[model samples]
Target: MTDFDATAYLPDDLLERIRSRAAAVDAENRFPTEDLAELTAAGYLSILVPTALGGAGLGLAEAAVLQQRLAGAAPATALAINMHLVWTGVAKVMSDRGIDDLRFVQTGAVAGEVFAFGISEAGNDLVLFGSDTQAVPAADGSYSFTGTKIFTSLGPVWTQLGLHGLDTTDPADPKMVYAFVQRTDAVETRDDWDTVGMRGTQSRTTVLNGAVAPADRVVRRVAPGPNPDPIVFGIFSVFEVLLASVYTGVARRALDLAVAAAKTRTSKKTGRPYSDDPDIRWRVAEMALAYDGLLPQVAAIAHDVDVLVDHGGQWFPRLSGLKHRAVVAAKQIVDDAMLVAGGSSYFQRNELSRLYRDVLAGMFHPSDPESAHATVAAAWLGPVGG
Candidate 1:
């Protein structure tokens, strides 16, 4: 963890520029187009693609480090990019485990194509395992997906949408189809990304009215409900780890802001800076402690994924718990930062206020509080029915 240099890829100057635009991007409720353009130019889109495929060939752990740095400056922008990384990251995961099925995804990223994750569906709790969308298979092995996908990040410019749908063509056994569809007439992007925070993401709704994935683009056809499919594990593992990275970065930024406030903001009562205030010092220490605790866990798990550490069945719960803790810790750190920074942070224009709003969106993301708890409980205490 100490050896990896996150700023090596996303340098401080570029991040500073992105951070400068975050407020306006959020306030205007638009995608971070400039950030995307800059990141794409920086080869960020192919972070996970193998060097053999003309990418950086970085591992998941390194990617986590980079994401945390990016998120610290501009969380929404990092998150908007997270979707694209998930696909390429999934490809890396599969590749690491000796599967080259999603190799084209890697090359596509290298060819300057943005991939968006479109597996999420409204009211669909069985994420990555099942879907409400329907997949109709053709004689040519192509499949047309007809359903709506919610929270489609990178909505404005994703060239390929990696999505899933339930295929019931085999009446006796239903299989979940995972495929990629290019942006075309069949795909509709609803401009409805107005949100409380993270508006810069513009993770709008995608309505796929029989959008097609050619035989080559059709990746997985695992049966519904907890299958031992590589794609499922790849998506879940990479998704959870990267999500944790982004939120942990948010917490790190808030902690830094609180420390800065403590050193600079003077306290009239004590005739000294807030840093001299014992109460303020204690609060700052607690926030630091909380943020510090999660770093090792996030790094270890991400590295485990990279090296293919066989955690066996405990993988799902471990990943879920990492994301849960990172988010919870980030939200707490931001709240404390606001308190430490005082009234100035309450204003909408302040970065802490923006972070406060941005962190709230974390709770709504997958591996939500309830589901995370359930996953951990079932993993540790055995399934309820057993």
Candidate 2:
């Protein structure tokens, strides 16, 4: 708990306010505007920016801790904010490695600019390596992205979108263009974000009809597939760790709720609290064991990223594995908590019910189970055909 203390960055009163709004945000399928305001005012959005740039100047280790705490109170709000943090975190990574390419991202974040991640596309299994969206290079070295990006969190309020697309106009030297586009008339947001859980995120579909990212905003132009580029490493490391932190927070809340329920609810036949029941005690213990294992793994990986521990090629596998474990464990913990709470938790209004839906969204994020397994297997046993 000491390692994950969120109060050091976020006050108890702020968390209470966020927690109080969770039910409403989820129920109404509305964005947590107030939560965003408070978090912004408290400088939560700039946690990863450098202190020299007027930010909290914290590393991924501290950011992970705060993310877990924030999600425990409001999962959707945290998830929405995660998109913004990803850009700043990536900027931090680049800066640490002597690359000043993303300093604009860091400065913009501190200036109250919300950066939405718009990399996810429909039927694009290649993830970071390839993009279905097209990045057509223009006369002035700028690029116009024209394709559909799905699951764009902060869709309603983002000032800029950090996205990537395939540039194949020059077939001889096709590249993946990574860039940021400011909100403009060319960008269209489709109001189609209703989902089973994490509803407050309002992660709608974004259709880019030649949305332009000026030459200066153009960040990288690497090959379509994997390379040792610092930007690639920065995106993967920060995204996976922060994502894992959010779901881990969800698991922690579920475990705590289960324990409270077990201690308060009495069994009719035994005329005693369910806490006295051996079966209930065992279930709670199981939940605790799963949650306890994830916390240290999250902390360790985040710490490694902070200290620049060179795991070499093993970094992706380690990062993906940690995310996979945290998400899977969180889902399992929520399922157990629902059972411990009995039929009351089956209600739509129940917090456990909301968590059940929210946790499921974890499976859909990047570094998914299949990809994580593939990455780890490749790391240990070599490529599938090799």
Candidate 3:
């Protein structure tokens, strides 16, 4: 029997650390160093490693729950941890291939060190196939990779690197050889990543030049077989869902502040408490309703993922829909919170302002609004048979 219990996987202590310093965490836009340490020490970073390797061996459902909880405390930290979760998931899946990738897994599981994904490129529109990076084969079947991958979150912090590139030597093979190279003397991280939102992510640019990638480090790209796990979409879903939850928590904080302000402030023109004003009461009510509305949808989608994964059906459409819905709802929820909070919400020091900016990143998730809608439509309406 597996030793995975979904309920016990959350990092409560790390959450406490996040809750305690949330204000300061936003105030400085600093990486959540303390929170990362807590996760590492508590084995939260290794949650997806198979139980045989001394990990929690939980599924994507439990992983989403943990991500959501972490984001509820700190969105920036949650974003960075998403990279760790993706690495752990990849390790677990690779382990099932009947080979020993445990060395890599153990390195990350014990030291709290791994890599951010290297896929996106600068000025590249077609992100899926736009891999400017290249990996050429050597005589001994080893590969030398060279290229710069931009917007790599935790690029500077991780001990390894996950990269994708086309093996042009086999043009007709239709497989872009994927590889993970050790972060030794070959890889370099550029001073980039000053973004509008998610500033705390430290998403720098990584340049790989003649990086030696052993045969064991290479994996197939988007393998299409009888059973494709759709792990990428699953990872994207976790990111979108948790980010929505975190922004919702921030909106909740804003609403709480608005309620307090309404009760205490007496409008000079009306000569009464703001809360007594119909307009003020209406705003508060609207904000509350929006927040309440989003929670159930997010929860229901997460539950569906759990149920589907348990019963064994590919949940591509469902996961895509959940990501789209939750992120869109979070945008609406935060907008309402800002509306109710009024001019005070604009202050940089105000948590709501930071959260408003942070939540916007949800729209750019891999399974974004447009793609997600298309996935659902294709599934429900079927193809045109063209």
Candidate 4:
């Protein structure tokens, strides 16, 4: 890749501190206080805030590396940071086109403002299929939002939101606007984040009653653009693939822990370490096979994106297939890790338990397994009606 000095953007020591703090934070179901601070101190939270604005100018590749490495340390912390990375990318893209609310991002970056993706709504089994939040225009040249957003990642901690909504009054309209809203202290948050997994993510419901969004605070919500250059697609592909990267890292650690457990425990009947058992070896081998298979696929997808870009053609199907493979591979890897670890994987106190939950999150993300498959099929086969 490019000779980008990522270390200059954020050092290793701080990442360790975040990791160390993450375990405890995950246990307590608390926000990763130290991790966020360390990230801010390293200017990692502002990696895409633009160099002109006194922030790191790292692009999507660097951002993917940061998330993947950090997720290896703490998946919850990494997932929380993923929201910010998304916001940063959104900001950077908007800024490049001069359609962004730089002041909001700039002010938020310095203010340590957390931006939540307020896309999920109550009663929606699927999170990405738009939202029920209504944004109505006012006579005073502003929009008033009235709705509750459910399971908002980093909900209680956010000072800003990348809110997605559509105006239903005009049902025939094909366009929906995404706006950036600044959260005021006056808004209320519910402490109902009781979940089976990713507890520390603090994903909860938020209520906005007549929350006024000013004109300047609104950034046009644009769909993620397909890469024109295959090479650039390779670089950008990292963003989607990194979810798999983080999950793979989590599964790898689970296997590591299992192997350690096997090495110490002796089989009562055999009077030997479990490591000597052929059955245990088989399980471990399976786990290793699963983990080993993921990295190269990601690398190849990245290369394909790069090639497509260099060749000057759309890499949509290639990129979609990459996403599909990444998600499927991640699920298989995590499931294999649990199988290798056995029933102990069910215990919340174990790291494997957390990894299990974090991996499940991937199945529901933007390019989820089914969605990725559909996108790839559509790209290759065209519409079925024709």
Give all TM-scores, in the order shown.
0.99, 0.98, 0.80, 0.80
Q: Which candidate do you rate higher for lDDT, 3 or 4? A: 3
- Order of the predicted models by lDDT, top scorer first: 2, 1, 3, 4
Q: Write the per-residue lDDT of candidate 1 for residues 1-386, one digit (tens) a residue.
A: 56767677899999999999999999999989999999999999998998888999899999998999999999999999999999999999999889888999999999999999998899999988889999999999999999999999999989999999999998899999999999999999999998899998889999999999999999989899997799999999999999999999999999999999889999787889999999999999999999999889988999999998999999999999999999999999999999999999999878999999999989988899999999999998999989
In candidate 4, how many Å is residue 143 off?
1.7
Candidate 1 weakest ten by summed lDDT: 1-10
Candidate 1 — which residues are off by over 4 angstroms? none
- In model 4, the worst 10-residue window by lDDT is 226-235
Model 1 error, position 86 (Å): 0.6
What are the RMSDs of all candidates, in order?
A: 0.8, 1.2, 4.3, 4.5
- CA lDDT, every model vs. true structure: 0.93, 0.94, 0.66, 0.64
Q: Which pairs clash (backbone N, Cα, C closer than 3 Å) in model 1?
A: none
- State in Å the error of residue 290, model 3: 4.5
What is the lDDT, from 0 to 100, of the residue 120 in candidate 1? 85
> Which order, best to worst by TM-score?
1, 2, 3, 4
Residue 114 error, candidate 2, Å: 0.2
For model 4, residues 1-386, the per-residue Cα lDDT tens digits are: 46756566556776677667766786788877777777777777777676777777666556655565677778887777777666666566445545445446755775677777676676653333355777776666566677888767776668787675555655555223456677775356788877656666787788877677777665443222332322123223444655555665566666677787778777789999988989889878877777677666655654443232342333545555655565566556666666656677778776777777777776665565666776667766876775
